[model samples]
Target: MGIFDKIKEKLSHEFIDIIEWLDYTDDTICHRFERYQNEIKNNAKLIVREGQTAVFINEGQLADVFKPGTYTLSTQNLPILTTLKGWKYGFDSPFKAEVYFVNTHLFTDEKWGTKNPITLNDERFGLVEIRAFGSYAFKINDAGKFIVDIVGTDNNFTNFEINEHLKSLIATRFTDTVGEAKLPIELYAANTTELSETCKEVMQPEFNSVGISLEKFFIENVSMPEDLKKEIFEYSRLDKIDLDKLTKFKTAKAIEAAATNEGGTAGAGMGMGMGFVLAQQMGGMMAPQMGGQQQAPMQQVNTMPPPMPQAIQYFYSANGQQAGPVAFEQLKALFANRTVNKDSLIWKQGMTNWSPLLEVEELKAFLGGNTPPPLPGS
Candidate 1:
């Protein structure tokens, strides 16, 4: 039997007092009231709750849209339906029409993600592949158009029917937006806000055309393949680290480790082995230069560095302003010029606090002529 006939058969003895969708489902985006089989009584109360809207459709034609409020199904209130029905005066009889309730609230936390990796050409890594996942929100802006285009005349339109289509649409838009952007994959996480805004701008027109509004789009994470991520990480680490410094530190640590061993065969003895290897290499190289002469004494090849003199520097403070770590010669000039006096505070590498120059043994000679200046408070 037809839908109307089935409803008529079920409600043959009685009639609906109120025409409204009282209980709505979470998954259902729109619901066509099952009163198709029964006639809508004149002056029937139509309740449109908050975040909801009621659309009246007459025999394959869209009529008036009722926002969130109590609507009285009268000829005066429904001028479009009344005109379509060709009612000269207000008819008090029942009428046949379809009513659909649309959910217009912002649906939040809806997930959108890539199932497989999306490959992009990267400047640093050549061809790179990445996957992104995030949440989005939307609302029904045009209820009549949504009913006409998406929900249609179905008894109920739920998320199950539209989930795949929405996901596919979002993915297509994202792919287009990302491809056109040519953004580096590594920057996706950092540039999520900009990317999300761009995606929304690119997708709004298409969504609006279908009676829905793309409210908010967000990208939470963009990840590459495990191997690719590891490679990128290693590349970043290698780029930031100084190879020369690393080599020097490792060599110094190796030398320190060797010195810590007390065994007679370790430490500087390893230097003898290294010296022997170096002498063999040197002999091989010098043999060509020596023109077959008898081998020279290997003891002459021992390479030891000469020790360097220790440098002593002094720092002085005058008038609350501290001065540099000057060498001994500069200190002598400063004392000769009287830039520093006998009581001027001076300090050096091993000293605790700044001491008067007269009290320091090193400065006595530079003081010149006559008895030494008395120490302060001595």
Candidate 2:
């Protein structure tokens, strides 16, 4: 109650005797401990509660960092700050320096996503564009580095500022990782967890460079354009369809459609045509096995009669040896080239022995027109 005692009490209040941060907001990443004149008394109480770190900066230079403990700030405890301040010996007076309390707790559920589509080359789909989004968790690993690199002199730093930078880093690394993986585009959605792990591994060093520890990264979804999705779905559907069954189904449908037609002659003709096509398809499907298994035929049934037993191949004498079992057309070519003349002996499958080409019945019609009278013989 004396005037001197009251003055001492007032002076103590003026100089900050306790330095701490009781964060009430969820987003704050770092909060500067505020005092009346930014001064802390010698041997002041500094409380860095669990999930927090206390850092002191001297003249804009990082000096001391205390992790998750109670400390009385002095030259011994604040050696870096004391050295930076050139305090060779401890002083009793209040000191002027910046103290920042960094939140080191795991910040969970931070969202990251591709701001733009990432273009990649897919083996099956060719060039494709896709996008992905996910959540992650991070914590401040090095309070000193974080304060110096990110917080700087900002009295209030929040998750929003850090997230903006991190998201860009993640996006860049994600694009690179995905482009290099060379995985199928469809697989991205199927293997999000795997992809997420891969991306986290690739991006960890980048996060470490900024004093943030990436604890968890998750890929919630990978998406592509609607047209691309539809195309992929259609391709899958076609691959799974049975072509023979599909042909039978269509032929039945065609028959039903032809039967339902109302036009007179045109409708009859349509029905007949459909019936003919149906017969051919059914014949191919039910054909007797050539060996034991009936291999599926890919070609349509020939409407023309079986091609005249392959036009009767023949062998002819050429270069003093039998040359070929060539068809009639090839024989004509041989004669035109003078490699086979009327004296050239020829034989076919049914012939008992070789005969002169001129004597063959099949060649007379061709030779009568093409051959000239022999020069007058002696």
Candidate 3:
């Protein structure tokens, strides 16, 4: 044996005896062993525990990758390294190489979200501004690609380095996936299940480029601007109101009121009150369906009947003061309250002068063909 060999032999051996990465950290995604300036023995024992991948690199070139289990480092176990190492003797001699332990188990609770409002041109709600945030889980599926692309020379590759990159990918793909659905901003919050799955598919291509496979993805909450959220909240709460229950409660109270009066007058008053209530309900149901509109009637007078426009505005005068410039539906409410009449002095923007509501002709049906009984004798 040579002097160096004699020294190594005297010490029983002079090469890396065992290679492992037992000190794992929560923030670490990939960790490379420093090897303490020691060379790996040809037959070194490599222990890759579960949820870990062992990567061999030499001269900045990637070599063999090993999964869980103990590996005896040799030409047979590392063909790529053997080729790179140019092992003429079947990798029987000690060689220097880098070993990186990649975290292959699912890395979870990684969050992604839009930092700013994402604006989308929706089909139904027009332009909408929304924000969405969520979490995802992933794992390194290709240790070779991961080591060469991500962990190259990075002794402590961590999640912080790639967190923003993943979030950017999510934002870019998020806009496309959500915009494609064409859902209104109001409806986005309710579509989490579909959005999560669709977003995963949308982001899968870029994720693979980074050597990751999505294990589990989530779209926790999608929300709109604060004003829009409040409006939606109020609408949701109001939608739960039961009109039938209110009607029953009102009827019961009226019956109670009638019972307190004497001389059977309460009975007659109750009958009239019930009739009034029934009439109000009927008028409400038919106001729009019966085409009891004021503005359109005059327009069709000069031409054949026209299609109802999507919306209409009106102006009216009641109690000797002007009270409108309101929606067609709002003006119709005045009729239900016995306030609109033959001489109610209602006018629309196109009219030349304020005229009796009856002259509008479109609102004539609201009068029910009566003149208010001539006001009990003029």
Cα lDDT computed for each candidate against the true fold: 0.77, 0.82, 0.75
Q: Who wins the lDDT comparison?
A: 2
- Over the stretch 61-163, how does candidate 2's per-residue lDDT look in tens digits? 8889898888988889888888888889887888898889999999999999999999998888898999999999999999888888888889999999999
Q: Which portions of model 3 show Cα errors greater than 4 Å?
A: 1-14, 230-355, 358-378
For candidate 1, lDDT tens digit of each residue in 1-378? Answer: 899998887776345668778654677789888874668888888899998999999988999999999977888899999999999899898888888998888788889998777878888888887888898888899999988888877888876676677778888888888888987666777898999999999989988987999899999888878887787776677767765433323333344454455356665664453344334445555868898677767867668787545457678775677765555645555565566789999999888887999888878777664676699999
Displacement of residue 27 (Cα, Å) in model 3 is 2.5
- State the displacement of the C-alpha of residue 269, model 1, in Å, after optimal TM-score superposition: 18
Q: Name the best candidate (by TM-score).
A: 2
Ranking by lDDT: 2, 1, 3
lDDT of 3 by residue, 210-269 (tens): 698877789998878787678667556656756443433444444445444534875676
Better of 1 and 3 by TM-score: 3
Question: What pairs collide in candidate 3?
Answer: none
Question: Which rank order by TM-score, best down to worst?
Answer: 2, 3, 1
Q: Estimate the TM-score for candidate 1.
A: 0.61
